[model samples]
Target: MFPGPTGVTTLKSWPESAARLIAVAAGRETADLVVRNGQWVNVHSREVIAGTDIAIADGRIAYCGDDASAMIGENTRVIDAEGRYLVPGLCDAHMHVESGMLTVSEFVRAVLPHGTTSMFVDPHEIANVLGLDGVRLMHDEAVDQPINVFVQMPSCAPSAPGLETTGEELGPDDVEAAMGWPNIIGLGEMMNFPGVASGDPKMLGEIAATQNAGKVVGGHYASPDLGSPFHAYVAGGPADDHEGTREEDAVARVRQGMRAMLRLGSAWYDVKSQITAVTEKGLDPSNFILCTDDCHSGTLVNDGHMDRVVRHAIECGCEPLVAIQMATINTARHFGLERELGSITPGRRADIVITSDLATLPIEMVIARGVVAAEDGQVRVERRAFDYPATARDTVRLGRELVSVDFDIHAPEGADTVRVNVIGVVENQAPTKALTKDLPVRNGLVRSDPTQDICQIALVERHRASGSVTNGFVSGFGYKGACAIASTVAHDSHHMIVVGTSKENMAEAANRLAEVGGGVCVFKDGKEIALVELPIAGLMSDEPAELVAAKAARMVEAMGECGCELNNAYMQHSLLALVVIPELRISDLGIVDVRRFELVDLIVGN
Candidate 1:
């Protein structure tokens, strides 16, 4: 049941709840709460109307106009806004709760004060580690929250065919079964663009299942080339895409009837470039949406959540009202939640944000479902924490303790100089560049060249504990010291990724995580410097957001101390194993040439 008095959470129950809503709107019944004397940011008319009052009953908006005196009763809770702008609560169109390193409830507790009332989360990261059971655990926790947390059934568990191997694989039957869930909004982003273009049966079957169930199909076409492959993938029935990084990418998605989601996360600053389609090119802004595809605990607790994205969009020359619409009504309309919780209209949920200014968007008070949930960066209401089962914890299982020899990159039979394909990291973006470097072999093994910022990266199989380690070289971390950074939060496959300048330190970092369940660790000079223990599915921490944020901040500091200065380098580190994205990536199987969608040899004879 919904937290509201009418006890209606789904559209199926709206028929029985309509009588009370209609009665309060007509002034025949008393409202439960009333907000007087505020300016309404009406997204329906795309205008800011002054002198507005909202009458709320049974946790739904009954009336919103200049006068609501007739609906006020003796028991109604009256809140005087004092002429603040009553804006609709923000909505994150796309995100992953595991990215925040917090569970669903803690994520809600963290973002509620930032005026985000709704989130469309894709749990594909955890799904790769625990399969359908993981999705069910997340879905059950999401539906119990005070805010709206819609779950998207993960479309691709391995994310790409023949590129990476995951612990659990999901098929079309899994997609069809998740459709019957109460909170499953749609299928998650179909990251296998190559499979979609080539008419792969499994990929097409999953998309058709979502479509047949009348649910949205999310897309992730990361390629910049908008060629026939892009057209073929679009023709395969995906509705919305968030992988656009350029203005043309946004324009192309909208031109093809897909919503172009502009994202501004901790590391991915894609909004400034893509939002130019609306600000400068003057394309239709209605088809544009705003989101944070991935964010860490530090960004959520320190900078802001949706508020940071909206403010950055405004700084990128978007009008404040237009940016707010992208975050609120546009996102709600895209997910078919416009009538439920997007606006301050009659029949929508009573979710309002009181702000002193439109340009800065200072959140003063947050009203979610007619209850004052948060005010001034703190939650006023209490939310219970979810206790994860022990089976979900202690997921790190390495059959044997790792050693420096496991990370040795053996040169070909008689080669002295080896030409290697390196995964080059781009700062503040998701894409990577494939670089080649020729280095001399030492003792018949290819060694890392720290002077060229080339470090060794290995993907250790953590799920099966086969003790398999695939090693490769990566650039752009700028590490100059004896250090290693290891994480079990690798995207899509959720394997253990360790990047280090020294193989000894890499072995030390990996063993530390295996000993302490699962976590992110930084080892320097054969000593552990910083660590953030996840211990839950090897992905998220069950601790409070504040404690996790503190630990994450130290991890960032440790990366800096090790001579890596990229912003949110841990996010870039975790995605190195994601084989769906372009250029190059590493997996437990081997090094993958993502552009060719095949496994490639790490070293070429020179």
Candidate 2:
């Protein structure tokens, strides 16, 4: 059996593996497999060498050069690449598996055909609901696969300390305990920028534990202000950041001795702006990485995974070789796995992608651990479904059925017209703008104005079944009909967020998610139009990725029927409660002013 360079629980067996790898390369031992006649993309040297043959032994690359006939014995399997471009398998340096709305096994099965062989995932979405045990469940399932899946222990549960509440809270002890687990990479994104800048003991303790274990610490400074606050966050021990959306933001991160990760996910198109740091400003490409911070299953199924991100980077004026380095070796070096599985060289894991073109980059074949895993957009390997425990399912507890009155926002006194603070959604971005709108009040209750595309948004506390509903306002959905969308995938906190133009439809949407344990649903005119039931931790579906992607596509169409014109509006709706990002967001506590990092009044001048 070919063993990948992953799931190495102990470091004692490396010496024996290294001996066999050297003997095979020196023609003293027989090789298991050899890939012939290909253009080897040497990410380490930033060059493409033609007519290269790779010898594999014990699932590790033994040689990469002009000829490997010496090691090819009678039993060796020869794979003729037909002179294709042999690119190293792509890696997503940062992401959330829960954002795909599928389990780890399903996520791997979806991206394997897309040439994604490694992923560094953060389970913070599940951590917000089930705590460390939830993270362990994901980690265990990640290692059982044939590819490399590194788990980053969630550093933030609520994300923000007091501005919002969650189903569970993770502390320094949780971080310290996860450090010793197999496949544990490092700490997840530290979203508590305020806590880090203020020298909060709890936040510092988690960073200290990760550094003591000699692991990487992810950063999330959502603020665009590169002032003293940004410098303070760097001093807090985070080694990289993916929150940057500008060229200057990337420059600042690299200048501060941290890697700047450019992300092109389902909704966030941030690569065009940040990649200019290398294309125009001539910054070193080694300090930059590529990732997909959050991608829905619809994007993964319709579009490619890391292949899509790499193509976008190449289109953004980056050289194909340079962009390949950003996705391969640059990511591996960031996580201290440079010699393990990044490049197609001796001693690295035998993960290869045979592509027909460098610019278009169509993946024709994928080989992981010297075995063919996928070919021509089809997964050929066997993937077993993980049987998630019953405790992980049925997590949506609304306590009681919500009614129209529960979503109504009462005005101050007997006011007829009221000015309220609203969360302004930015197209293809994570940060929201704090905008105020003046609207008519009927029966002393503030209502949504569909003519102006202003809709009412609410956050329902489902963790403890408190039946607490906090209502606010949001703009820019362009929703005109009597429709509502609800989801249990609110980022960082995982609360149920309901956004709609009608109170009755909003109530209907919330009840729909509660009925199916948890998931996303769209309701129009007091009836559910589409839904995707995610029974595991109220975050991921136990079904196949293609099945979840189908339901998500219908949900997107439902948003279109209701007058939403934004691309992937469900992704934007799910992020309305993410309090870690600026400038405004709603939470279980109340409407939070993220810039101020405090709970503020929803009604202005009250």
Candidate 3:
């Protein structure tokens, strides 16, 4: 059996064992494992060939041909595929492990059973809280996983420089230093599109460092406009983009020499809309890849991971072979790892998924590095725990106990009503709408109108314990009654974001997270209704995925009880403070007009 965490680094390089692999392929030596009589779903050729036999040695494919009978010996372990489809292990081209609400080890354990053998994770969420130390922690843990877990150096710590503030800032120096790490793949999604287009030194320096290291530069151009700004951003060294929402967005990215990553995350339903670029428009499918940008623990444990994305793509009219290619070889090629993995061809890592069906893609068995990792929807390997240091926990510091008055928004003196800018939540999407509302003032304080589907949103600074609260208005949660939800998982800045219909409930929810180190909690009528403790830098929990999923499911139920009917509304709540996406977002600094890339007053014309 393979030794647990150290097995990853101890795996011999292909060169060190090439002679043995050659001998096995030449039928002069027996293979360590031989899988016979399978229908190879050849992703490279977009074809399925039956009666294929694959021989593995030294954790890499030695030979895949019509027969490996000559390489069989008495000691060789042989598994009869029985005509099962031997598909390449699915790879999530882009994702955030922290968003899963589980530590790296737990996230890997949860997804491995779903046939996700490789993950390209961007730890920007944790970077917002613990800076370089946070990113290093995840990187170290990721390298120890049994499967491929590549870490992308975070490109935007604050996401937007002046629009918000983070616990730490990562500049070009940090990016360059991280590029030398063992598993560092590239710079993460460049959320600062405006900075890149305008030739901002810090953003350009990071891109240059990744390019200099011959690594891929990921992109996040979260704008609908495919005009000059988009073109400028593409030229700024980002080789791929996963923020495209429309068919035109996908088309434009591919046309500009950038790979278009179509995502089907828990809350993001973007695949159906953008997949037409290939199905209808007849663009070459090679430039298109599938990914899940963000998925919570419940989604990973219950629904699926990359397998879910591939099935959804097939449902969107993509052929099974093409969808499988998008999820496998296309992702590997995008990251310049075609020779390492992504296919069942010789010399690649022996990462294969066996399934009886192509369309449904039920993962009957998963083999990673020539070892059985998962089978029958269960992980077969031992679960390894990566202990996070004490410094990574108990990060939530509210400076002082918050009260209902701390959430009050003082109105202009003697004003009965005021027009305010509200952050409008768009269901199943990342961008919010900038909305203006005429809200009444009571006792010289601006009030939330629950009847109008409007509620108060506050960004409480947790990193520095500044006791600073930036309050604003938001709509579209459909929340009723005296309810509030607070999470320290706010994007980019990782501040505590509280959305509530009542000031007292908002205060209670905020204080609840503070009291428990850090996590997400919901409050109704001054009582805690649900909670999920994410004590690791306040972005992820150290617990198992199922336990966290149970808490998350209860939290979702609580949201529904409070009258929020939006699908995956909790995801929407967490992103309310992401200053990089469109329209409006609240931050530690103030209400951010993301379109304008500047801070705007909460009250209009004040």
Candidate 4:
């Protein structure tokens, strides 16, 4: 990657006559390091120029031009550039580190090789479990890294008030405590969009603390309506948003002076839809930041990080230079790091990536703070392995063994056929529908219609397990073959969600997962098929990312074997309980009508 960058930068600036003369005169002087020649893709100038020599000292680029011979010393390592394009290391504007199911150090190793130097991370998933302590643990790990990893204190614990109950709730006090941490950049995504718009005191207090600290506040306005509520949220001081799934959403955020972060993660292909705001509508790309809100370990190891976003933007008709600007300098500017690491400039961190092709972005080498961290798809420094506390494991408590009677949905007496509301799952999307279906009530028990693919979905309360199980019907999995899937990795609230065609299989799936402390398990004909043990707060596995990815892949294959063929099945499974993102979801209490923001009954049309 270093040689590629040297080649690309040198090719672009070869026309300067005085630079070559100076280089020839002062061949080998004293300097910390020297990359003999390279081509530089300058995001600020929006130009690709070659014949550039980068001089570095004290982890900062002292000079970047064709004539850096005067800066080179006998001890300085001279790396010959074999004509590769040198660009600034990529920056992820918004992301959730835990979403990848990797600890901070593991996530760093996975992405560092891909040339991602800086990240603005939100750990709301863990915060929902362990509150401020969890946030502190993440913050402590971030400050010790070799590269810049900024933490954003999570503002919403349950995500939506009155809709769900998380294990721990973070209020304004917790927000203020995290604000002073060394690595904390600001508040995380304000997932409580309604709270911010409605002037909820607790939400406002957290936002005020972030603003008073002089850090940028994050936003999450997921609703389609861009009306007064949206206006009120802008007034609440969230400086950036990543939930803009449309061009109108992007325009609205930018018009209100918030950076619109377009994402193209493994599960979310939002960039193609919203990049038109800049490429077609001619909106300024400066306020638009590119990010990957959630990426699994597989995508990180196989596909590139910010390079993927830049490629997607270019494919959506954005100019190559414009796309680079969005991923680099534009992102740095949003985080108030414009003068630091976003560009290939003097006094900036000598973090850069060398790629063979800008369009393909085949990353050959990755450098961070003037040291090679990864080369040719390999990590240079050993990544740290964190130990999950004993208390973190074995957190799944079922209270008592579940019985078939627990899944029974009581309806009005003597009703031959009952019309019920079902949480209709949508594949590859966050939203669910309040679907209704009339079913035959036999033996005083509501049975699932396998022909209609309306499988039984249940939320077995894991936190403070009062043995409270909320059962409902959900379609769209296309499950068959007496298989059941259970997971403690439910989003926001982190309850155990079980979906199955057979109650017996469901019980086995749920119990087997509990036996392993906490994890995702699939059962077929009362026998376990696959399980990914997440013993840490019942959220993340302590295993290496590659091992975890393999387990997750097996889980996906198990879902496929069970007659379900949805894209990124585990993602859909994890997000089933995310009340903030959609029309309908299930919680420990009962089914939630997200549109109305109220607790809804499992039995409808009673």
Please give, for residues 209-246, the per-residue lDDT of candidate 1 as tens digits. Answer: 99889989999999988999899999998888999889
Tens digits of per-residue lDDT for model 4 on 69-99? 7776677777766778888999999998877
Candidate 2 stretches greater than 4 Å from native? 1-13
Q: What overall lDDT, based on C-alpha atoms, would model 2 receive against the true structure?
A: 0.91
lDDT per residue for candidate 3 within 313-432, as digits (tens), equals: 999999999999999999999999999889999888889999999999999999988888899998987888789999999799989999999988999999999999999999999999
RMSD of each: 1.8, 1.9, 1.4, 5.3
Instruction: Spell out the clash pairs found in candidate 2.
Output: none
Per-prediction TM-score to the true structure, in the order listed: 0.98, 0.98, 0.98, 0.93
Task: List candidate 1 segments past 4 Å from native.
Answer: 4-13
Q: CA lDDT of each candidate?
A: 0.90, 0.91, 0.92, 0.81
Q: Which of the two candidates, 3 or 4, achieves a greater lDDT against the reference? A: 3
Candidate No. with top lDDT: 3
Model 4 CA deviation exceeding 4 Å by range:
1-29
Which pairs clash in the backbone of model 3?
A: none
Per-residue lDDT, model 2, residue 27, is: 94
